[model samples]
Structure formats: structure tokens, C-alpha cells
Target: MSNSALIERIAARGDGVTGDGRHVAGAVPGDRVRDDGIIIPGPNRAEPPCRHFGKCGGCELQHVAESALADFVHDRVVGALAGQDVPVGEVLPAQLSAPQSRRRAALTALRTGKQVAIGFNAAQSNQIVDMRECPLLLPELFALIAPLRDLLADIAPPRRPVKVKLQMLDQGVELVLEGVKAEGLDAAMALQDFAGAHALARLAVDQGYGLETLWQPEPPTVVFGDVTVEVPPFAFLQATTAGQAALVDAVTRAIGDAGAVADLFAGVGTFALSIQQGRKVYAAEGARDAIAALMGAANRARALVATEHRDLFRRPLIPAELNRFGAVILDPPRAGAEEQVVQLAAADTPVIAYVSCNPASFARDAKLLVADGYTLDWVQPVGQFRWSTHVELAARFSK
Candidate 1:
């Protein structure tokens, strides 16, 4: 065992890193790499469940055991913060979403002659995997794959790629097909019958122009807490319900007892709406459609949520404005909130709950906040994108 090269951890791109700095593909932590490049199976390695394990771009860490998988997620955050020289605080146990829990997915489909191939693209390539079985997506969403193949054969142009987006709304599955044309009365009838037979929540298509709804029984809505908001086409959503719960719970704990909160980069009120009870929340977002949806839901629920469609990057809240709120919830995109964090650093905001998808970017921003006297209290890691290298987390920063 001492002679063997020991795999210590998983790298950012899903490769296993040995203690001596060798990167081994398809290797998991605790696995041993022999001198001749043979990999000895480790206790932390599990047999990949899907047939397309190595090829499909949907999942990268399916071969990792549950315990090791959690470690990979937890280490991603700690390592990132360590890279930025930010002090690591209490790291709560990692929360992993169950398989088949993914509620939203965007897939690529191609039609060649009489056959249509559809699934996620092959890892790092444009080739579609032609999905036979998926253990990642919700069963209801995966059920549409076979039917979609047949449907796309009729509408999707030959030999061209079409984008298929599926989301599980409260009503049912919302389906959106882009790069597809359904012309003529026969094509229209086929789409109508398909939507009716499948009981689709909403079905829309994009030919060459923008998305046009072909069949919508009702406005597709998703519930945040108790309030329901009709989401726009392909609206951003937390990958899984369990994952969303983990983040929301972390956020609630992070901003404990703060009666006034500001939710920056609020996407359709994921954090704002969930944490609005007994508190006044000023929700600000850049996307017009998302803000409009949040405002409508908050108005209808009579919640103390004030919505504004302002891009935090271009017009960040100044220290004077930021000091008005007792606490701030910053959930920025993958590129982190640089401008807003700069302003937040100068403000007297007592508490900050920062939710982020990219550990590296979050660590970069956390460095800024810490330099301004805010303490990095704790971070709760979430494996929302199960079996993937992607990581998300919620953290607390106190002044």
C-alpha cells in the first residue's frame, strides 16, 4: 500500500488527484494507481449505475461512493476558500440530493433520416448520447424522452440539432422545443394531440423566431414556500426539491431573526419568497421576467416583499442603501457578485447570507467581505447536481 500511488482527492474537473500530483481519469479517492497505470478499485469507488457513465455529460461522479461523494462536495468548498486564503469555518455535513430528483433539464436532440437521437451531449463533444435510461432526471421528465423522439421526427428538421427543455412545474411537465418547426394543420394537430395525451402543463416551440406557445392548459407555475409564481419559459430553478430545501434551510439559519432582509439577484424569489414571512424583504433582480413574476406572487400573497428590476452588477446598492437592511442574502450567478460585494463590504449590514453555485467565485467574494471585518461564520455544502462536479452552498457572514 505504501508503494502504490494513493489517490487523495477529486480535482475540480472530476479527475482523481494522487498524493504525488498525478491526475487519473475515472479514478476515485482511496483508489490506488499502480506503477504501470492500472487502477486498483478502492472502497470509495462504486460501480457506475448508468450505461453512459463515461460518455454522457450529465454526470461525472456516479462511480464515487456516497461517503466519498459527500467528501468531494465538502472539499470543493473548503479547498476553494483555502485557495483564496479565506479562513474556513464550521462546515456542516454535506447534503446530497437523491437520484432521479432533478426537476429541470435542457437536452439536445438530432434527427437523421427516419431516426431521431436525443439525450445529453457526449462529454466535451457535440454528439448526443441517445438516452436509453437516465438515473438523474425525475421519472416523469425522463418518461417524455421516447415520446419526444417520435414527436421530433415529425417536426424537427432533418439532420439538424434541436434543443429540448423540460421542467417539472406544479401543474405538470413544461416542455419547450427550440430549433423545431411545426408548420401546416397536420403538424399543429400532432402537437395538440401529443400535449393532450401527455397532459403537458405547457408546450411551446421555437421555429426560427421566438418561442410561441402551441398548447398551454394554464400558466405554468412553481411554488416557493406557500406562494405560487407563474414562471416564464426556461426560468432558472434550483435543480432538485431536496437541494432547494437544503439551501433555503441554510439561508434561514444564516440570517437568523433578522426582521429586515435584502435578497440580491433574487431569481423568481427562491430565497426572498421562502424567507419573507414575519420579515420585510427587498428583492432585487436583473431579469425583467423573473422580477415581474416575483412581484406578482408577492402582491397576490400580500407578503412583505418589495421587488425591483435592477441589475446589481451595473447599479449595486451603496453602503447608505445597504445599511437599511438588517441582513442581506446574496445569491449571485456563477461569476459571483463583485460590484455588490464591494458595496456590501463598506456597509454596516450586520449579517449576510451568501448562496453561490461556484466555489471558486464565492471564495473570491468571501475574501472581499472578510477584509472588511465580516467573519466567515460557516458554510453548508449542497450536492444539488448529484453525480456531477458542480457544487452549491450557503454561508453566513457576520459583522
Candidate 2:
């Protein structure tokens, strides 16, 4: 008899798991692993598009078929809820971002002699992969990699790694380089020419002290609904436009007809501004710069979005304050809003749209809400970081 085990599903870390509790790397659902440690390609295995698929840490599930990828995303959410014994009324279909849809990325660059290597770090290592082509980044963003290598070779310190951040703004791509020094007139001119030649919205560098803008012809802005926020350099943004749309749509649906909403942990008014048309939104964030940008945008747009710079972890909304809102939107960091959720569960809030990047933390908070009589109405999984183990989700809870 053949000694082989079938991969049943993908685990949280992107490893294909067998029924008997064995984990296989680079295996997808339906794949068979022979006793001699050879993988037999299964129906759900896909041909990875990028040459750096296995080496680059940017993506993990590129070898998974579309259907299996979606399943992995959905199962991640469902399994998380199950672990917490939280019952969900429905598990909606997973929304996966298309190839080349990533709008923001943080890459690493290192210069050795005359050559420069720029790309994501290798899997489980600090070494750069030297990206030549990527299917995860937008075409416009990917096009800059080659030129960036050339640019970094001149400015990047010898054999020292530099952090490169690329984000697409309303004007154009914003580039920020850390651990790079450009001294004297000629180097400064090169930096200016590079930004202008690439039509970059903003280019900032950090040598040691702090980030200093080298070239910024115009403010780097991002639009959240009708409001235009002149975002700070390398501010947080949804990974992809499609993913943002899916989350926004789900949030809008989750808080149907609610006239008053409290957006906790609101970053740059991504959800508050998007849903502030007829509704009165109260946006609270811990980051000063993000809240300031949101406040400025709301003030200029004259939108019914009030901004507050309050750290919810230290001082979450009390029951009295929480009860005021007809609905609530919670988009906390990876460590979910446990402190805030406790207050929300004690309050008489009617509806909630909890958006989370980490399913484990989300489920833990969901248990608290459910225990307080809130129903887990539905969950919508979003594969924003495509071909990766990272998962995002939006869920509705109602009393």
C-alpha cells in the first residue's frame, strides 16, 4: 500500500496540515505527501506566478488554487470563532484581492559593492530576496523596483540594510527610505531628479535623527469617501483598493440605517468618512497624526465626523457613552479591542461592525459580546493580503 497523507487544509501559518497532525510546507489542499517526502501535485495546487514565490516572504499561498485560497480564508475565520465557542449565523464568501492589487508595501534594500538588492526579506530570514518581478504589487509600484535598486545603490550604505516603504497616494507613489544618507549637492540633486523623474508624490529619507522630506512637490493625500486627507508620510492604508471596498461595503451593511456611529481606533477616517454622509460619526483614534489628518479633512469637507484623540485601551468608552451610539465600528490593531469590547458588551448598543486583522483576537472579543447577548449575525472574510496567511474580516453583532 502507498504511504501517503492528503493535505486537508492550510494552517494559520500557511502550512498544509494533514489529518493526522502533520504539517507540510508548500503543500496545498488535496495534495499528497509521500513517505519519502515528495509532494504529488493535487487539484488545489496552483502554479505560482512569481519566480520569487518560495523565497520571498511577501507571499505564502501562491501555490494554492483560487478555490482553496478562498476556503483557507473562510476557514480561518470560522475556525477562530469555533475555537471560542462563538456561534455565527452565517459565513459569507471570502473576498480575495486581484493580482497586482497591493497599494502599499514595505521592502528591504541592501547595497554591496556596486550592486543593490531590493525586495521583501526571505522567508524566515532577514536576507533580501532581490525582487525582479512581483505579482502582488500594482504594476506602477512594481515598475519602480528596478530604478529603486539603481537609486539605492548610490545612497544606501555599504552592506547595510535599508528600509524602503512604497505607498500609492491620491497624487502618486510616495517613497520613504530609512537608513540611507545623501550628503552634499550632487547626491541631493540625484534625489530630487529621481523623485521628479518618477513623478513621486513625496520622497523622504531617514539617516539617523528623523525623517526629512527631500522632495515633495505637493501634499501626499488619500481620499476616504468625499474627504481628502493630506496623510502623513507612509501612513497606514488598506493593502488593496478592492479589499478596502469590500470592508467598507460590509461595514455599511452591518450598520444599516443607524444615524449615530462611533468609530473606535479609526485611522485617518477610513470607515468614519466613508459612512458619514447622512450619519453622525464620532471618530476616535490613539495616533495623533492620524487623528489630526482625519480632523482636518472632516473640517474642510464639513462632514458630520467628529474626531477625538483618545486611547481606548486606557480609557474605553463607558457604558453611558457607549449607549449613546446607535451603532459602533471597531477596527482595532492585531491585539483586538478587549478593553473596549468589555465596555461595549456592558452597554445597550444595538449594532456593531467589528473589523479585525487577526481572527484569534476577533473571536476572543466576539465571545465577550455573545455572552452579553449580542448575536454573531454574520462574518465576511477578506483576503486583502493575497497569497498570504494574513486574514482580515468584518463581522456584525446585534442585540
Candidate 3:
């Protein structure tokens, strides 16, 4: 057997060394393996706030200390760029919202013949982990968890997976369900019972037992800087509060002396309105609802802003369009803006700040910008989603 292939198969468990030297265990829980075949501790190992620590796949760093996680992420970003002439900045500590602060969405499975919910995906698999509560989700969300489990258990399709999506708006909580199936009129009775008992604001079903609805008496809203952003039940926004804040800070700092800014892939104007205090901002996003809501919010705040609906993936900035903005802020999806980066590099824009959830794509695009004479000023890491290997970063490129 080849030595490299042999080392690949070793799976070390429980912070200790197996008799074989192939893998060394580290104190951390989620991510331990380094390039040198050494295991390292996870970020939340020292103090995991949630009772579901180590077991819940949602938070990989539950077993490692928060401070350590910051260092670990910073190192990971630095290591990711290795020989690049990029300067590393503070790996900012995320401002953690109270447990159950997630106003976003997800679904879980139902235990067969049991009145329990199999919540969240298992580590590295689609299998759901049966859970009573998720600390990371908003506290209001927890109230629905147990009752929903009971409702599913009593339903005919007891073994089906159910989705629980909650959006907290300015008025109240909005709840929706998906992937449920029902056999008869009894399902309607069940829905009514669940809604009444839960005091839901809306109770709408999708097709069968696969869909249900529950919500608070009003809409769900969030506060960003001085603005309160209202969220619809089925809209897209950042899942973590701290992560969103950190990203906004990074983008604002990158704008520096620029008087006019163009924000691409702007969702709900999280960055546009917040950073437009002293500048004219143009936000372009493909999501109709998000753009419309953002435009309304901007007008209410009396901020100078305009919204455009465009799929940035298919069509980014043109050369002529680039010279119009003093600076640009991009918060593209995981696929990072490759074509946009090229156009910006060729344009006359003086500065650009990019927020990316995926590091590999960011590095690839950064390399392109660097090739075009843009110098990377800061590579800051934000540990927004506390667990798993996913990392969010903000970078500044100056012409």
C-alpha cells in the first residue's frame, strides 16, 4: 500500500492518538486535521454555550473556545493564500445573538412512530438528528419545535420530514412549513388545532402533509444600524446577526473617501442603506422582492439610493458603467464574481471591497485583480457561522 493512501484512511476520534501514528488527535471537536497530519482543537471546545454541543452538526466549533476559533480562522485564511502578498487583518469576533436568534429557515425529519423531530442534518450526511431545541435558532423558534414534533407524530405520515421556516419581522413572527403529506380531512383539523394552539398569524398549507404554516401574531423585523429591515417569510438574508454586522463594517471601511458607491448583489440593502449615510448609493440585485423592499426602506430613510434588478452572475458591470462609480462593494454568492472582477480590474474605479462566504473563489478572483494592478489591502475573516468549515471573509482591493 502506498504511504499517502494509507494516511488518508485514518479516522481519529476523541482527542487522542490511535495506536497508529497516522492521525494525532487534538482537543478541538469540529475541525482538527492540519496538512501535517496533526489534529487541532475546534473553536468552541473550551466552552460550548448550547447544550447540543458536539452532537449538533450546526456548530462544529461548539467544543472549542471562541477566541481560539478566531485565531484558527485567521490562520486558515492566511494559509489559504499562502505565498500571496496579501496582508492579514484582524479576524473579527462575531457579535453573537442570543440563542434562538436565527430569523431564517430550515427543516427537520420526523422520527417514525415517535412524537419527536429529527432536527438538522447529521454530520456529513442528509440524515436528520432528532433534537428538541436548537440554541442557535431564535428563542421564539424553539417554542414551535416541540409542538410541531407532536403535530407531525399524530399526523398519518408520521415518518415524513417537515420544514420549519421562521422570519421575525417588525410586527411578529412568520412561520411556514414544507414537504408534509396528509391523507384526508383530518389534516385540516390538525392544521387548525396546531395554528390555534400556537397562536399563529397565518396558517396556510402547501399541498398535503408536506406543507403547513404557523406564525406569531405579526411580522418579523430586524434592526440594522439605524434602519429596521422587515423580512418576509420566504426571503433571503444573512442567517447570523454578527456575520451581517461584520460584513457591513468591512464594506463601509473599504468605501473610505468615495462619495458615490455601487453595491452589487445587494440584498435588502443591508450594506447599501447602512453605508450610504454620506454618499449616493446604487443597489443592483436580481431578487424583485428584496430590491423593492430595499428601495422603500431607502426612501423612508431619505437616503440617496436607486435599485436595479439584474442577475449579476449572467451580466456584471460593463467598462463604461464602472467609471461612473467612485467605488464598488460586492457581496456575491458562493460562486464569487469572476467576470465582475475582470471588468472592475479593467475599469477606472479607484477602490473595491468584496464580501465572500467562499474563500477559494475569493482567492481566485483576488488573484485576477492583483494581476490587473490592484493591491490587496486587507483580508479580514469573520467567524459568522460559528460551526462547520464554512468561512466568511471581506477583502479590500485598491487601484
Candidate 4:
């Protein structure tokens, strides 16, 4: 009746099926269950070594078998789209890289009077767990967590558990550390010491109110498909390397050999630059900061990318504007592109590649697109956020 034994027993009892016939394999119950009692493949059927699996919010499927998890998610998307007569395409295999891939940026909370700890928001709470290691981070980043704790000790509290966000870019890792009441040389020296010890490429310390400076003791570089992207601190970027590669490939294939393409809600030009092959790409975003990053990325790739800072929802599509492109590539937020769907339904654009993170919204939009004379050509599911109920999807719509 020790805690370990108690947890194990609970995991065992909670691991399969409940009285109501729900699958208890994953930490979150009610995930997969069929009339014949077939549990969908996911973290439900397996056990993970991390003691924090269920407590920590990072891995939703930690208790389920990793091998079967991806397909389980794929099935969910297919089911959603089936109602629209939209056939779901192949489910891209899950890219599960350990330690380094778990996050591009994380919002860590302060633990009172102890070492600095980083992991994720607690189960349904804003609090972060003081974690030793995560299976999702890169090995190098995984190695830095303990040392990062030591570095945080130098800074005074009331201002503890600073929000830290890190991203892997073309050149190197970008670090953004936020302190509520930090300032002056004390903050700079503290960050400097930590960066030197960790051999970080650049350090960005948030000075209570805003960004202080990008400490460039030395530059760090990350490689992606023979190209290098410079990562600025606090800039939005993908967390996992393998996941990004799959998404880029999906967008490229969806675009085919289009001469003119429009990338909607393009962030850092991940798809815009990737799809440009001596073609014109108009990248648009609502945020000026994101648009700047998109422009920078396009410049780095030497691709012909024209950027516009406009709210796609408010403006939707003006037929005069929509007719300029043969194809459109959209990567919208979780809400998905509702207004764009309405506009596209009325437009003459022949092709559309819609990338979404929410299946419900994608399905809702698919119904509208089908009603507008567009057919779901294909859908490729990408497990960008693994170990969670959430899944990323890319689909092509053609006339």
C-alpha cells in the first residue's frame, strides 16, 4: 500500500475499460472505445516511465502505448470529415523525437523558495511542475534544465519561476526569459553567466516590462533542409524539428507547381518560403510582428514573397483580390478560416491547401467548401502535438 504500488494499481485498474465501457488506457478516460470493446491505439494501452505523466500536462497519452497513438488520432479526423463526404487522406506517421522536441516555447511558473524548474502547466492549472526531464525536449535542451534551475537561483524572488520561452531556429536556439521586477546590470550579469555556462547562442532577458537586449556572446545555428534561419528571441517558431519537416513537406506537395500562391496567416514563412520555387507568394498576417518575421524569412530564402498585414477574418476575400492567385495556402489559428471559406466558395480560385490544428473546425469548414463546388482532394494528418488529444491536419481543396 505504498504510493508507488498504489499508483501502479490505480494505473492498472484505470488502464483498460470502465463500467460504462469507456477506454481508460490513456490518462484521460473516454478516449477510444467501440461497441466490440476495441480501444483505439494511443497512450491508453501503454505505460510511460515519467512519474509526472498524468500530473504534468505535457503528455496526455503518456499512459497509452506510443506505437498505436498516432493512428488513433488519425481515425478521429477521418471520422469528423466523413460526414462531409470528404475522404481523409493518409495519416502521416507521428514524429516522436525525445527530450529536445517537446517545445519551441514554454510558459513556466515560479516555485517558491527552491530551484528553478521547467516543464508545463499543471493539470488544468496555471502552475508548472518542477520537472527533471521531459521526453519531448531536444537532448541538448534536456541537459540544460538542471543548470537553468541553478541560474534562476541568483535572481531574487517575488520574481521566481520566470516565464522562459525557447525555440529552435535555423541558426541556433533562441531564449526568452521573463522576470516580473528585474532590471539593470544585475539581470544582465545573471543571464550572461548562465548563457556562458550553457553555451547558448543568444540570450534575451525580459526586463520586467519589455525585452532588454539580445545577448550575443556568440551566435548559434540550427539547420533545416540545407537552409539556415536566424531565430530572434521571443519570435514564434515550431517546437519540434521532426514535426516541422513533415508540415513543410505537406504544404509543398499540396501547392504542386502553382505559379502564383497566397499564404494566409503565414508565420515566419514556414510554408510560404518552402513552397516558393521561382514563383510569387503573397504572405499575409494580422500581426505586424509576425509579418516582419515572414518578410525576414522570405528574404533569407531569397524567395519572391510579398507580405501584407491584414486581418483575414474582417476582410475575408475580395473577388478582385482573390482572382490574382491560382492557388491559396492557409494556416489559420485553431478557430480555422471561416470567413476565408465563405470567400473562397464564391471565388474562382482552383486550389486551396488548408492547414488546421482543430478537427472539428476543419470538418465544419469542409462542409461549406464542398457545398461551394470544391472537393476534398486529400487530407494529411500531422501529429505535431503528440501525447495529446490535439492533432494538426493539412487538406487540399480543388474544383
Candidate 5:
């Protein structure tokens, strides 16, 4: 080991890399690695706030500096495109969701010997880390950990696993407990009291029979733009509000002033509701409950959003139907809407806004679109689940 090496960038798995391509875990860019194998600290490193930083699977890059984290997010999108040999016109700075702003999360709770351990599972393991303090979750969501532990201790069988779902609705917190039952009279009363005391918007439980509403003063709804859509159990919403905003803004800019747009894989009209002003949007979703909710909200608001219940994977919108729109919007699942993208590739829609959580899948689909004469104009990377490898982006493609 003759020459000292300098770390050039962070890798996909949160590891730092030198110019010669040596991987160093917990090392940041501009850091130096001496011949003696000592890592000199660099500017792109941050002290992890949580005590369970190393053990908790909730976060991986907390030790990396903010700039490095943002770089990692931005690089992920670029790297994915490079892998597929897709050319991009521009790549914007990464938009990161702030700490303590996660509006929804799924947690696991296990009760054992008069104690309840409630938190996320360890990295790549089933073991749960009892969260003391989380910098990622909304303050409101974290506040329920203690009370939820107490509630689970009463109803959950000893040494049994309980799945806890928490969401921040416009009205208040909504709690859904699965793998636990409240059949006994005392347990039922306890659940009702817990919901009331916490001012929960709704409380439901599933004891293998499926979720049944235990307490609900009113239906649970989430506001998307000006319309209030009745949310079904565990429906898909962006993990963070800021992340959602960034994605919506990019999509809106991509299809600026387009007369008619088609929102494929529209989950409860998250984009349709926001970007549909003065424009008629044909929103299609596979989920029955989600489409119903979107239709109800659009009808109530007179939003000019036409809702349809169709599985894009099974019966994608053909080019003939897709060509009628001035622009097309796609927010597909992780697998990346191959069947639909094939149709979109040859469509004469002129503009396309593709929102994706998986960069690799997006790249694969982008190649198909590019082959059919669509130009990859620009991309906006968004880091919603911060400190993790999960990356999302919105890209505009034109024919």
C-alpha cells in the first residue's frame, strides 16, 4: 500500500468508494484511506441521531452526510439510465423528504413476557428493533408507539406477532391492527377506549377474518389537491408529503397546460386530482376500492376526472385510445408497466410523464419508449424513504 487513496463517491449500497474502486463501508466522499487501512474522516459524514442506527433496518445512510445522501439518490437515477443505455437531456437535483415527516408507515409488534417490542425489523432480518426515537417518522406517528405497545400487550397473545399499520389522515391518525383479535368483552372495550382517547380517525383489526372496523366516528379520507378521496384500508399514498409534492410538481411541469391527459395506474387520483385543473383526466386504476374512492371524490368535486376500473397489465390502453390525449401520465408499480409502456411507446400522445419508485424498472421501460422514437427529455429524482436505497423519479418523454 504505497499511495494514499481518496474516496470518490458513495456506492449503491451506502458504501464509499475510492478512485481505484475499493469499497469502504461507513466512509464518505473526500475521505482518505491510508496505507495502514485507517479511514480519515471527511466532510460528507454525519453523526447518526438514533441510538439504534446500526441495528435498525429503518435507515442505512444516516451516517452519510446530507450532500452525499442527495448525491447517492441522484446517482441512482442516473446509474439506472446508464445501465440501459438511455440518454437523458437533464437531471435535476435530488429532492429529499425531511426528517420526522413520514406520513405513513407499517410496523411490527411482538408481545413477550409482559413487554411489547414495536418497531421495524432489523436490516435483512426478522428481528425487530424496539424504536426509542425515530427521526424518519412524523412526530404524531412516533407518539403512538408507547400507547400502541400498551394496547397490544393487552390484546395480543404472548409471543405472538402483531402487524401495526399507521397512517396520518387529514382528520387524524388511523390505526389498523392485524394478527390480533379483540373478541372478549374487555378487549373490545379497551380497543374502543384506546381509539377514543387517542382521537384516532379510525381503528380496525384483522384476526385472520380480514379487517373489521372496531371504531370509526366517520369515514377515513385523505385530501389530494382540492378533492377529498375516501381512502381504503392500507391504500397507496406517497410515504411523505414533500415527496408527493415534488413528484406532482415534476409531472405538472412535464404536461404543462395539456388539454386532456391519461393517468394510468392512478391510485386514488393522487396526480389526477392535483394536475387536472382546466384539463380533463382519464384516470384508470386496477384496485376496485381505490377507483371507487377516486370516482366518488371526483364526482363530488366535479373535477372533470373520468374514473375507470381496469387492469393495465391485463388490458393496457392501446395506442389508438392513448393517442386521443395531449399528454399521458404513468405512476406504475415497481415492476414498471411493460404492457402499457409498449402501447405508450408508439402512441401519438406527444408528451409522457412517467413516475416510478424503481429506477431500474423505469430504465428498462424507458429503453422501450426510446426505441419507438420517444426522447428522454429530463428527470427529477425524489428521495421519499430517506437514508435508504429506495429511489423514485419523474421523467418526461416526448415523441
Candidate 6:
């Protein structure tokens, strides 16, 4: 057997691959992997910043240096395009968010005896890692972990697991605890006291019926380009502020000076509100609460936005309706917008900005649009989730 081999690149699952197709975990590009499974650190390899890097499951590529981390993010997007046989004119450099910038995250809190553990689950397992130091979460979110453990120990049932979601709003942190039942006045008082002490923007609990607001002195909101949209409990938000700006910039550049734009799957007008200057926007979303937030914000701001609460998967805007707009922007979930892409293929919209979390799905939809008439102009890869394998991108398609 060969004594050693240099890693060529990082594969999709965060493992380093050699030119000869050998996969070595924790070996970054230029690192040498020996037959005995020891990785000799190379130029692109950097010491992981977190003590819990390998075990926490919050980060998979922490072993990779910053330069290599960007490469991995860029390659993942380009590789997905290759898989779909889609050609593009330009693939811009990848943008990776800095460590400890994640604004929103879902963590698990488990109570064992008198102690409670609160953190992300380990990779491929239900066991919680009990996050002590996370480099990916915002300081505001991580600050709650210790306090949460103490609070949960008092209220949570021993050995029972509950999900704790945290989001950074403009005012303060918005906390949501699911699968928790707080009975009697003491438990309720504890929740109120926790919220007041933490200065939480809002605190909601879900005992199974649905999310019930426990404490919200004022309506929680998130600002997107001057407009403040009321945030629903545990609403979908861009993982980082920098990532949202990158995507919004890509979308604005894609639809430059367009008289009208259509934002499909517009969650709380993330793009529509940001890019709707001097133009009319038609925003559609399936989620009722999300659409309400968008509508309320747009209306309160007196912006030129038309919102419709409709599921694009079942009733996508037809080509005839889409033709009314000069440009279309679609930010679909991981499943991608197959039905919308089919309609987009036939629409007369001059430009399209697609923001996607799943590259494979985006590539699939890109294929359909390219075959119809649109030219693949450029793509902007975003590493919002940082060291995780999750890939996201913003691209432009024009006819």
C-alpha cells in the first residue's frame, strides 16, 4: 500500500479526497494522509478553534483553514452545477460568514436527574453534545445556554427532552421552548422571571397544541432594509446578517433597474422589502404567519408590495401572470421550486434571481430554465452555515 497520499480537495460530506479517490476524514487539501490513518497537517490545515469541534456536530469543517473553507464552499456549488450539466458564464468567489455570527439556531435541552444539558445533537445521533463553547453561534445566543440549563433544571421534567430555539431580534433574544408543559403558578412565574431577567424579546412555549406566547412586552421584529417586519415565533430567518446582505446584493444586481419584480416564496419579505426601492413587487408565500408578517410590514411602511398567501407548489404563478413583471426572484426551500421553475421557463420575465439552500435542487431547476432560453449569468455561493456541509447560493438567469 502507498505510505502516504496528499488530499486534493474536500468532498461534499466534509471529508478530504485524494487524487486517487481515497477519502480521509479531517484531512484538508494539501494534507498528507498515511496508510495508518494519521493525517499530517498541511498548509491549508488549521487548528480547530473549538474544543468540541469533532464531537459537537455544530461544525464539520472546523479542521479546515479559512482559505480552504472558502474553497470547499465554492467547489460544492460548482460541483453541483457540473452534476446537472449546467454551464454558467461566471462563478463568483464564495462568501463565508465569520465565526460566532449565526443569529438563529435550534438546540436540544435534556434533563437528567438534577442536571440539564442544552446544546446541539451529535452528528447522526440523538445524543446531545452539551455545547459549552460554540464558535458558530452569536454571543447573544450562546449566552443563554448556561442560564437555560439552570432554568430548565427547575422546570423541566427529569430525563425528558425538549427543543429550545433561539433567535436574535432587534430588541433582544426570542426564545421558544417546545414539548414543555409548565403547570401551576411557580412554573409560570419562573418563565416570566426568566424572560424578564434575560430581557428576552419574546418567550413562547409549545406544549403540543401550538406555540403560545408566554411573554412579549412589545412585538418582536426584524429589520430588512429599513422596513421592520414582525417576527412570528421561531420564524425563518437568514442564519447570519452578512449572509442576508450577500444574497440581497446578488438579487439587486441581478434585477437592476427593473420596473417591477416578483418575489416568490417571500418569507417575511426578506428580499422583497430589501430590493423594492422605486419598483413594484409582488410577493407570494404559503405560510400564513410568514405572509402576514410580510403584508403587515409592507403595508405599515407604505411600500409598493403586493402580497398573496398561496403555495407555489400547488398553484404556482402561471406564465401569463408572471409576464407582467420585468424580473422574478425566487427563494425556495430545500425541495426547490420545481413547479415554479416550469412556469418560469415559459414566462417572459427578463431576469430571475434564485436563492437556494440546496445546490442539487437549484441545479435541477437551473437545467430546466437554461433549456428554455435563459442564460446562466453568474452565481454567488454563500457559506451561511459556516463549517457545516449545508450549501447555499444566489444566482442569476436571464433571457
lDDT of each: 0.95, 0.95, 0.67, 0.68, 0.92, 0.93
In model 2, the Cα lDDT at residue 156 comes to 90
Candidate 6 lDDT over residue span 83-198, tens digit each:
99999998899999999999999999999887898898888788899988989999999999999998899888778789999999998999999977787899999999999999
- Tens-place lDDT digits, model 5, residues 145-237: 999988888899788789999999987899999999688899999999999999999999999998899888988898888888988877889
Local accuracy of candidate 3 as per-residue lDDT tens digits, 268-305: 88788788877788999988878877877777777789
Tens-digit lDDT track of model 1 for 168-283:
99989999999988999989999999999999999989998999998889888999989999999878999999999999999999999998999999999999999999999999
Backbone Cα, N, C clashes tallied per candidate: 0, 0, 34, 25, 0, 0
Model 4: per-residue Cα lDDT over 10-84, one tens digit each: 121234444543444443333444555444443335657677887887766666555556555666577678756
Error of model 1, residue 226, in angstroms: 1.3
Give the poorly placed runs of model 3, Cα more than 4 Å off: 1-55, 83-101, 154-156, 182-205, 208-220, 300-302
lDDT of 4: 0.68
Better of 2 and 6 by lDDT: 2
Clash pairs detected, candidate 2: none
TM-scores, all candidates, are 0.98, 0.98, 0.80, 0.83, 0.97, 0.98
Give the Cα RMSD of candidate 1: 1.2
Tens digits of lDDT, candidate 2, 1-118: 5699999999999998999989999889899999887998899988899999999999999999999999999999999999999999999999999999999999999999989999
Candidate 5 collision pairs: none
What is the model-wide C-alpha lDDT for candidate 2?
A: 0.95
